[model samples]
Target chain A: AQTVTQSQPEMSVQEAETVTLSCTYDTSENNYYLFWYKQPPSRQMILVIRQEAYKQQNATENRFSVNFQKAAKSFSLKISDSQLGDTAMYFCAFMRRLNSGGSNYKLTFGKGTLLTVNP
Target chain B: DAGVTQSPTHLIKTRGQQVTLRCSPISGHKSVSWYQQVLGQGPQFIFQYYEKEERGRGNFPDRFSARQFPNYSSELNVNALLLGDSALYLCASSMRTGGYTFGSGTRLTVV
Candidate 1:
């Protein structure tokens, strides 16, 4: 079993500024994947970014990037030049890599952090 | 292409009643997964299906059941609903190795 934790319940950032959301996880598996998802008022879960455990190089998607510290089990998301559209509930999730006989790709998620971008 | 589509955007049911939710995966996707998101919380995995077979199940009780069709569409049925079942149910579709694309979700409220 794996567990993901988001210590910050809420965060606020001014538009065009930068914000970082923290995430930590407990997993014994050596290979897996980490993800950040955002859910707006429309209630749709949208993928923000992803990181592969075997890759030392972090992942970056435009204004979104990740600081992944594999040894410490820490994966944090950095949103630069934040906009009002970034205001939403952000969740951190973990997924184990598919091995022999692994039939499904299940995501274990954290409680979430509510991010508000102030104008 | 159309994304994952779930039917009945919102539904309200009485306690102990039964409800069935539907999902239509993307045109080429062969896998479908279901999740439940409670208010103020992240979504929890409920079930996953691939090729019309059950691939994985979460910690939910047997009262929660689901099936996949030949077309890769899916249905989640919950019997003996409880007030705690009031939540948003999301459906996602993907290739075996790709990232998941989620639907807008169906809001189920058990009274």
Candidate 2:
């Protein structure tokens, strides 16, 4: 079974500053997918970034990016030039490969990091 | 143009009562998945349906069920609801390979 773990329970950042939330996972597969999701008080789960396990290069989107370390099983999200609207709970997730050993197209999610952006 | 949408933004039900949540996927999307998000936690997958067939299911009890309609919409049903069952029921749609677009979710509160 694949499991995701986010060590930070809460994180705070100042407007225009940066914040990095740490996440780690345990999986036996080599080729898989990792994701970061944002949930605001509005209760919407929005995708932030995704990383392919096989890709040695990390993924970046506008101001959001990931630092994926395959060997260490670490996938941390970095929000640069953070805006107030970016304040939300961030969840780290892991999806196992279909043919590897299981069939749960399901994403194993961590307990999430509650991020609050201060103005 | 449209994204995933869910109904009954908020609902309150007592323990042992049945609850149903609805979701409409993005147009032309063939896959719909359901997740349960409890307070202070990330969403947990409950079920996934494709082409009106059950393709995958999460670690949930038999009381939890879901189905996808011909139009690609879906519904999640929970029987004998318990207080622990109170959560935000989220619906997500995917095209292929499980990169999902999620809805705002239906907040279900079991008393």
Candidate 3:
């Protein structure tokens, strides 16, 4: 079983500043994918960024980026130019491609970290 | 295209009563997943259905059951609801090739 761990329960960042949220996972399989999701008070999970285990380069979308260290089993998300709208609960997730074709892939998620962007 | 859609934005039911939640996947999606998010906690997977068949189930008890229809719509039913079951129930839709797109979620309050 794969388990994602987010050590920080809460994080605070000033407006326009940068913040990094840490995430680590345990998985025996070498081929997998990592994702960062954001859920605001609305309770909707939104994909922030994704990293393919085979890719050496990190993934970035707008202000959101990921620092993926496959050897260390670490995948951290960095939010540059943080804004108030970015304040939300962030979760790290893991997904392993199944060997069997035509199968639905499952995701394992971390507890989450509450991020507050202070003005 | 429209994203994942879930009905009964909020529901309130007493303990021991049954509650049903509905979800409709995105236009082209074939997989739908259910998750529970308690206050101050992360969303936990409850069930996953693809092509109208059960694929994955979580650690939740059998009291929590869900089924997907041929149209890629799904429903989650909880029997003998407990106060612990009060939380936001989210439905996400995705394809085998990508990540899930989630709905706003239905808030279930078991009083």
* Predicted candidate 2 versus true structure: per-residue lDDT over A23-115, tens digit per residue: 999988878899999988888889999998878899999999999999999999999999999988999989864333333367789999999
| Residue A90 Cα positional deviation in candidate 3, in Å, after optimal superposition | 0.7
The worst-scoring run of ten residues by lDDT in candidate 1 chain A lies at A95-104
lDDT of 3 by residue, B1-111 (tens): 888999999999999999999999999899898999888877888898988988888899999999998889999999999999999999999876568899999999999
Q: Which ranking of candidates, highest lDDT first?
A: 1, 3, 2
DockQ value for model 1: 0.64
Q: Which stretches of candidate 1 lie over 4 Å from their true place?
A: A97-99
Best by lDDT: 1
Candidate 1 residues A52-99, lDDT tens each?
999999999999999999999999999999999999999999987433
In the range B1-111, model 2's lDDT, one tens digit per residue, is 989999989999999999889999999888888999888888898988878988778899999999889999999999999999999999999877657889999999988
Worst 10 residues of 2 chain A by lDDT: A96-105
List the candidates ranked by TM-score, beginning with the highest: 1, 3, 2
| Docking class of predicted structure 1 | medium
Q: The CA-based lDDT of model 3 is what? A: 0.91
Q: Each candidate's root-mean-square deviation in Å?
A: 1.2, 1.9, 1.2
Clashing pairs in 3: none
How high is the lDDT of residue B18 in model 2?
A: 96
What 10-residue stretch in candidate 2 chain B is worst by lDDT?
B92-101
Better of 1 and 2 by TM-score: 1
Please give, for residues A8-106, the per-residue lDDT of candidate 3 as tens digits: 999999999999999999999987889999998888899999888889999989999999999899999999999999999999999875436775777
